[model samples]
Target: MTYHETVIIRAMNRSRFTVQQGQAVILAETADDRPLKEPLRDREGKIALSGLSLSELKQFMKSLGEPAFRADQIHSWIYAKWVKSFDEMTNLSADLRNKLNEVACLSALEIATLKVSRDGTRKYLFRLPDGKLVESVLMCFQDRDTLSACVSSQVGCAVGCTFCATGYLGFMRNLSAQEIVDQVLSIQRESGKRVANLVYMGQGEPLLNTEHVIDSIDTMIHSVGIGGRHITVSTSGIIPGIEQLRDENLPVTLALSLHAPDKQTREEVVPITRKYPIPELIKSLKQYVEKTKRRVTIEYVLLKDVTDSEEQARQLADLVRDLHCNINLIPYNPTFAEDGAALYDRPSRDAQVRFKRLAEGSGKTVTIRLERGTDIEAACGQLHNAYKE
Candidate 1:
């Protein structure tokens, strides 16, 4: 069977499940059905309450025999005050706090590993409840006084980008909305600062896991109070997923991982392109722009010799010029070779400048992404694979 066929089969398996209790325990077997291990739930089978908005928290409190006004107090302590423990919520009565700690648990993901690059970028590896691992990265731009956290939506990538190390592990599973939101919170806790922006560009394709990703974005915006416009979701041309994102009418930025301009090149590098071609992907993106009236971002990773040529740059420029969008050129991060072949050769500074100039000449906004956390392998496509090796 082709790789595409295999991916479809896996997705089908994931979707055929019935949950037991409040937990996401899937029951598949007949007679003594076994509980499926949930990825983000704490040992006590609870997820962090941090992602719930005031309204959602009110609804939840009402369901649990508490007054809705208590939700406002909970929200303040969780998001505004950033209380680490339940006892630290001083405004909350000691009895109520004890009750909350008993019936409802505060879930948090443990930091399994952390690596800081000489460039000051921080990458954190978090261990989920099921023992599966996912990563979140913090890119700090001291000069600009900006910090952005790249969060993952899945443990391993299903998109199978040939150049990405995350794809090597294949598809493990989709992360819950809680898992996605926790990555952002965990990063903030580690840095002791609120992130200026959020990017869903780590580990997996954000679009492939649409429901959880959108729910996570909603929580980040409405609950966590992060501005929707400051958030970006990066996808490798998942057509249906893009259409769903547009229908949501959210102001979050949509970024397409348009690594290559041509069909053959794109198909070779991003296997999903074979299923959703550039023409179709462009149609979805245009619809997104028209619906949301927000500029889309086209993320192009420059691979040495393969796609860094002037011809490729011109094609990329032409491809995105018509769409109301910007181009973010990311230098390729080195990864372990499939056959011991070299792939780390990033484009020289001169070549990157030339490519940026060419793309901008097409009247589209273009920005070159600075490589972050390379020394500690915290740069893009550089995590998890080391653990595998």
Candidate 2:
């Protein structure tokens, strides 16, 4: 085998995973070679068949005495054909299909609710196996459909950004790599459209859960056929995650959720800033640009009278000036309280114009994002499981 192939094989051999529960267990080849009567669960849990890598699937098939080629067939069925069940693999033998039915499942998310906006933005609240809710969004444009597919790395967020709704919910457990990949498949199945783009800017900090994020990236690129350039993984300034991304050498776009420019203003909103801090974060981002030779995006949420002032804009421009990056200014999409009060005012047209001009004047690329699904609460900082039972 080639050197790269040998390295990949070694990595695959080292990787350990479990199947999701309730699937029949594959019997090991023994003197009897008899199938077990009861279903088996992996030590971690039963593997959800949909997200298995080709390598993982090969290992699984081997335990069943199935030929190694069967793994490729299964991979094609799951990733290319988008099969939702083992029975869909018409080429597989009936006996093999029956064996798979006992031990594997396709997806773990149940669609709790879906809300569509007049502007063609659709928000989804998916109920997980553990009864926790995570959200994803589909945004349709005239030219192409960008399934924001805002996937969560963690159930809720630990960053606690004051403007974000998910932060208020606090942190839950991290999602498995398969769980992350399943979100896109589930959405595509429901919407009857292929996902054109993916953003890891949903509910949780992706960098904090880098391993699964990287695995999901692999599945999306190799299996789902999403281009590396089209996938954007946003982080709330997690320095370690940034370093990890740099080292991994993946070409996916990196977006820094830099809501505020100054350290004081940043800490007030994004609590994670106190730990990583803006200067250190910027320094790392510069190194990332040098290493990857890719332009990063600075995602700034424009809150009225808060982060949209002229001085803040200038400061923000200065902060990112040295780095090869563009700025995306998203206006505040407020989450209201029970008393009918908005958490933060949306930036005024004049304020947005002034901020954009100031940042652009400093020789930086800037864009004031047009609002989509704000009426449906599918905009930034608005995805926090708004569905009830």
Candidate 3:
């Protein structure tokens, strides 16, 4: 038999299979065919009870012949009180606590590494149940009294933005709603502060994983009680996903990563622009504004000698003006080259000021995003797939 056929046969026999070196190897027996006593175990210890909202938790308790009020107690302990362990919930009866320990888990992410920026920005590296690692950042601004946490939607990104470190690792898998929510809680615990705003702009494209991303947002707003207005989902112009967001009628702000204006220029910086061109993307953004009646924010990363030209700035202004959106200019963060040859340079201070002037001159609200946590590689547009390496 051919190698391909051999692999399929082995995969059919095995429950767990992995393809390596152009060969398929069976790893474990199929769960359905296995004996009841030898049930397949999740080696990663993923919490099966994750994604349960407060109401659902109550329903589950009722189903188990327990008091319905216990659901509210558990929800308060898990989210409002931010308790990590089941035993710490002193309000719950000892019997219920023991029953919960037998089945459910309270926490999903285990903090493996934590780095604090000099400016009081905290970056956390969480080790997931499956050994996958993701990063989240909490930025504290004293003047604004704002604590915003930047959370990752995926372990690595598929949209290969030429300047992004996460793009180099390629796409892994979409993180579950639980994994996404855990990042916020993990950072909140470490900082001992409540997150005022949540941005889905950390490591991956939020729109690419539309379902889980929406579910996570739902949990944040309804279950976790973070205001929908305070949440922002940033995307690299996934057109279909943008359309999907419009249908949801979610109040969260939509931020488009419009790194470039024209198709040719954008395609050079953002590879996904080839698939979903600027014209279609613009149409979708306009539709979104009309549907939601909320202004969109365009995120333009200024790369020196790349997209920071006067002509590019004008093009960006015209594009946002047509859509009636605001512009957030982010100076590129210098990242090490894949080959370790040279570091990518950020926009010069003068160029940034000039670009800001051009953008603001277009009668649109424009803000130059200040770089934070560059010392620890925790600034905007700097997260990469480091745990894998």
Candidate 4:
């Protein structure tokens, strides 16, 4: 393997991961997780026949006394053909199929609730095996022929950005890598359209759950056939996660949730900034660009008087002047509440236009994000489990 490829393998952050409560157990998320001593099982204790990486599947097939090549057939059947059951893998022997039914299961998440925006944005709340709920969004753009899914890496967020909705919910736990990918699959299964793009700008800070986030990206590309370039992982500026991702050397995009331009202001907007300040975050992002050769995305949320002022606009422009990045200025979505009142307001249209112009003048591309599901509080920063049951 190439040096970077070796680094990619090393960066998976693999460790001992326990499985379901009942019978079998296994270790096989990353290549470094070692050859398994037991069968791979989901949280329900059945040997999990779903969501295995290509190499892990091969190891699994070898364990069953099946030829390694059976991994190809199973991978193709589950991911490419989107089969719901092993019995549907007609190529497998009937005995193997019966055995699979007895000891293994295809764990698909149950849809707890679905909400549709008039703008064609579909938001779904999914119930995990342990009954924890997470949210995913599907947006179909007629103009671009793009179907994008915003997926979560954790159940809720720990970043605690003062202006974010999910921050109010606090952190529960990180979603497993399969749980992340299943969100996209669930969108496709329900909408009957392939998701052309993925944005990891959902409930949790994706980079905080670095290993599974990268693993999920691996499955999305190698198994589910999504292009690496089509995926974007957004972060709340975790320096360690940024450094780890830089080593992985994937072609996916990186978006920094730089809601403010300066260190103090950024710490106020993106609380993680206190840990990884603007200068340090920028240095890490520069290293990321040098490695991946991918332009970083700077996601800035514009609050009415706080971040939309002329001075802040100038600072925002100057901040990204030397970087290979674009600016996406998002309007404040009223998800953060105080005593039943929305805590922030969207900046006036004039301020947004002026800020975009200022940033564009810095030779960095900038666009004001169009509002999507504000009516249902499903827009950016609005992905807390509001529809939780």
Per-residue lDDT for 361 in model 4? 69
* Alpha-carbon deviation at 170 in model 2, angstroms: 0.3
Over 1-389, each residue of candidate 4 has an lDDT whose tens digit, in order, gives 44347435633443323333422345555456454233334556675555666676775566566787888998887777777778899999999787667656765576889988988889998887777888898886667787888899998889999888889889999987778887877677677778889999988999889977887888888788899889999998999998888887777899998888877777777777777878888899999998878899999999988778788888888878889998899988886575788878888888889888877867988988877767766788888776534
Model 2 over residues 1-389: C-alpha lDDT tens digits? 44245336334433433333543344343224433212223333455666666776786777666888998999888777777688889999999988776665666677899999998888888787777889988887766535556677789989999888888899997877777888888887788778878999888999999977987888788787788889999999999999988888786999999999998889999999999989999999999999889999999999998898999999987887788999999989998665878888988889998999998865778998876788888988988887755
Compare the candidates by lDDT and give the number of the best one: 2
- Give me the displacement of residue 67 in model 1, in angstroms: 1.8
Per-residue lDDT for 1-389 in model 3, tens only?
Answer: 44235334333332333323422223344545651111111233323334455544654565455777887788777778777678998997898777667555666677878888898888888887777778899988877877889999998899989988888878887887768887887676666788879999988899989877876787788777789899999999999899888877777899999899888889999999989999889899999999889999999999888899998888887777777788999998877785775345777899998998887766888889977888888988788745533
Task: Kindly report which residue stretches of model 1 are placed more than 4 angstroms away from their true locations once superposed.
Answer: 1-40, 338-344, 385-389
Better of 1 and 2 by lDDT: 2
Candidate 3: misplaced stretches above 4 Å? 1-51
Residue 16: error of model 1 in Å? 22
What lDDT score is found at residue 42 in candidate 1?
71
TM values, all candidates: 0.86, 0.89, 0.86, 0.89
The alpha-carbon deviation from the true structure for residue 350 of candidate 1, after best TM-score superposition, in angstroms, is 2.2
RMSD of each: 7.3, 5.0, 9.8, 3.4
Ranking by lDDT: 2, 4, 1, 3
Q: What TM-score does candidate 4 get on C-alpha atoms?
A: 0.89
Q: List the residue pairs that clash in candidate 2.
A: 19-45, 19-46, 19-47, 20-46, 20-47, 23-102, 23-103, 24-102, 24-103
> Candidate 2, 89: how far from true, in Å?
1.8
- Runs in model 2 with CA error above 4 Å? 1-10, 13-46, 145-148
Residue 143, candidate 4: Cα error in Å is 0.6
